[model samples]
Target: MAGVWRQELSSLQAGTQNSILIGIIIHSGNPKIFEPTNPRYGFGGERAVWSFTFRDSPDDFINVTVWGSTEYINSCFKSFQVGSVVEIINSKVLSRRPDDSRDMFVPTVTSPLQITVNEGNALIQFHDSEGRAHYQPLLKMPTKTMDSLRSLNYVLQNIEELRDQFIDLLVVVTFIGEVRDIISRDGRSFKCRTFEVADASTEKTISLQLWDNEWIRLSELWEPRKTVLFLADARVGYDNFKKKTIVSIARKTLITENPSVQQALDMRLAIRNRPELSPSDPYSLPSPKNITNVMTVQQITQKLNAGSTGTDERVQFFAILYASITELNLDSKDANLLLTKCALCKRMVQKDRDSCMNLDCPSGNGSREPYNLVTFNVKLNLKDDTGYLVGCRLIGKAAEQIFGCTATEFQTMKAEQRMELKWKFLLSKFDVRMQVLGPTASITRAIYNILHMSRFETAEDISFDDIIDPMRNH
Candidate 1:
């Protein structure tokens, strides 16, 4: 390392030799193993490869790729995570080609040249010397300037004009959905997670899908409403199933969470006054405009059974269920009907404690007090003429809206008052808006979440028999 001259990424040229480059890893991808096409290539064995994005300055970042044995690549991948400052010694610098297949997955960077590190010719290790702290802060700096950023409201308003185009966005994380395993038709499997983000310009939120394993793992650290993301070159497209424009992490996209930019600071300040939702409930209630889809009990069952994602139907749809609550479980003595969860970690907490005790949570790391949110986790049985759906969830804010009271208010009520409130829902037919999460490997039963519910009157002239008769006749 002594013989190598230190080189900044902006000064890196294709012919540079015996140079050292220092940067913080901003995006770490999962390691992949590939078999050599020819018998002479890689000695007919599988070779391991890993790729990541690193930056040393505000406007200078490059894609760094490592090629070696499976053990070597895996070890390197595990050794350094996204925020680690690394010193690369003697890495081969080469100009990026337009037709390079590896470029399809690598994020577009400010630097035109790419760093390639092989086992023998190059080395990448953690920077342990003085001034390494300077590189670490670069991890949160936006790759693109604020001038290029677009508001979520603008993108939504002009989605038709900008379809299939990529744009930079600065948004606050509003929701993070569950991570799921996906298997393609070709038998390859990977992980994906969907989350929603919003900006100050709009109250509407947009969902973005994370397909990279590294990003999916990193998203676990993102806190709803508190995390700010600066997504560079995020692809915008229309979701046919949901009938809305959506954002996704594309090959050209580089995400910097909690970016140290003025836009990020302003976006966080804009959202600071908004009331917080339960961390356990990431999916919000569908607006009246989106709750137009109508589905019967049998149709919902058929949709779950015909799902292509194994037993799970990963796509969520909102539908109107004109059913009555058969079971409310209000009179039961079970202790779990109401759940107390830590807002930061989203883990269940003891009913007696006000703070989170989860040792793994960052906010609960003894530096600050963790916030707790009391939520209703009651289950209800719903039924119509076609069939019955059991164990449907009525949780968090949605449950409070339907029950006409807060969890704290309900806690103070007597058993007689609780039964009276339960009867109000049980005896009356209601129009219900629900989100459906079909069964998966981890969850054996389909999850039905009642988003909104309102009582129906006989004078309204809507009848369940009238709705079912047409389907039965057809």
Candidate 2:
């Protein structure tokens, strides 16, 4: 007989028996059916694995994976959804070993422990009203203000920035184009929808995409310029064919109409003042128009020296990719040095014994699991015939694009590979555009944020200079 075992999720260990755990479900995956290879099992059977990120405290959650027979999945867990409290009794803990795989984007649990429900011995039950009442205070802790939500972090990021990294986002939309159904090469048809969104932090309009059922539902409510949409938990990733960033919704994403939050209302006002719709076509998002005031490297340096340019001004310019810097060659005194960021909040976090040390962070407070994400800052030197700018930073998506891989992938490369990559970028030339964040007492203190980077292409149809110069004239 299994001995009595009851412990908090934080104390769960392998080999525990007659265990009991209770927490709310955060994410669940579809069940799969498979045939057992052993001759003893003659027929095919089904099993499903679901992930539960539960917490007794409202501030944080501990992720638990539960896998069991189809009968248990359908009868006991099928009704479970995010926010549902569940009680799991009589399970075994199986510790997962560290994986050294290259795909960092794939979700990996840092917690070594996982619980398996023993078929006949385990029992699973949903909490009734009285049971749920105990958790109500924790659950009813005031919903975070929109400003405090994680989605606000990426709202200001431009399309180019969004494309450079794999990130989940929250965005507010001011305009939505009509929906269209498109056929794929496999002769299958799917619905595609495109929309335009803008935020107070940026003047440029961002294009957004939704598909199939999401499009069908959103299309009915979506209005051109009239409807304001608050989209949460959408993913931002690159589109290979289009060579740009795209935002798509996932199952857990929240879509709401007429966003009344202060931040959304402020962004809507910003959009109304400078209303411009990006090309509605899903495949086409044009590059930023070249302004006549495009400054040269000399002009930018002189302006920085004089402290004449407004900090808020987003200036466009052209410069050559003159050099690249590695961590080995970095000056010890550089203020904008690289540091690791929290995956959820993008805030600098200190690593504790195993997990991150930001007690206020949900990941930090919820579970003892180590952080799966860490990022480094990359710097490039820009120059022209007139002057040069040293240590120009390329962060997040820009840095990822420059390396031609994700930050996680770059971090895993060998020392020699990383050194070789530095030289490769040093050989390339490009037109660089950036926004000036004003100068401090020293020229080195001035900050420039990369807005876009394009290769120096010289083709028969249209040369890079030909396309850029004409736009400048307009």
Candidate 3:
């Protein structure tokens, strides 16, 4: 440390020796083990290699690669994490080749040179001086300025022209999905997380992936509908599974959480009153063509019970059930049986409160007119010869299809009329097409969502004794 000269990443030169570099670690990749070989003699033992991105200033960041024995490389990785300021002494500084094949596998940084830290030749330690605080705020600064920012709308509308290219985006996160493991072609396993983000330009949200171990861990703190991101050099490509153009975090991409930009503030304000994502939203239900399976209620239960809990498994299947509705609570006076949520914020609106009562939503303000949504959230008991599926959801447009009226129209009917509508489906066999969500850590019980319903009347299946008079039962 005594003979090494301190240098900023921007001033790094090729073949620099005895130089100290100080910066905050921004992104870290998982350590990799590879067999090394020498052309003169033979193949050497397996060695570990690790790499990370760091920056000293907002405009100066570079990729640092470390090579050494597995023990040394793992020790360095455990010692530092993203946002930790560190000092590298005597690491070789080399100019990056324009045609280097490694460029496609590592993040593109602002520096023209890269740092190589080899064990026994260089030393890396956490910065201890008061000046380390200066690098902490750099983590939130956008790698690129607003002049180059592309809104979600712009990217989507121009996806054809931008396909297979990189673009910077400023978007607000709307959904944070669970992390899943994947194996690479090289037989290495890694963890990846997919999250959705949107901007003021459009209501549509796009998904981005996190492959780096550090970013995947850091994304756990990202709150849906609240965290803003400035994604630099995000790759635009086509997703064959989703059958749409998508953006992903590539090796050249860098993400700044809640970036210090005016557009980020505006994006947050624009989406403040938007509806939040919910579980098993009917709007995102699979098309009828995709729902080919027809499993019985007992078979569905068995499949759910057999599902493993090792990963975040969100198993979804569609089935057809010929069941009679035993319980429909439309005529019940219980307040919880019928509830309303604010159309804008998707929060439950109290009966006494005209608005959602969320301070962040503009409708909650007294002067502004409040808009409420009273969607059908009715639950019904479906019974078949096999078993009874209690508390199956018959909500939204699906409920409207059976009742032959909108939720608003149904609310205007009298108690007698609501009971009349309920009796039409009660104790009668109907063909119900539904989606079933298996039990997960968040929700213990299986969720049955009725997507479509229609009466089933056939000479063979019909029974005269099943028909009952509602007035006599009342």
lDDT of each: 0.78, 0.51, 0.78
Task: List, residue by residue over 199-255, the lDDT tens digit for candidate 2.
Answer: 555555566666534234435655444555555445566677667666655443444
For candidate 1, write residues 142-179 as lDDT tens digits: 88788998888888889888888889989998777656
Residues 91-145, candidate 3, lDDT per residue (tens digit)? 9888899889888778878888888999988999999999999999998888877
**Clash pairs (backbone) in predicted model 1:** none
lDDT of 3 at 9: 81
Reference-based TM-score, model 3? 0.60
- lDDT for 342 (candidate 1): 64
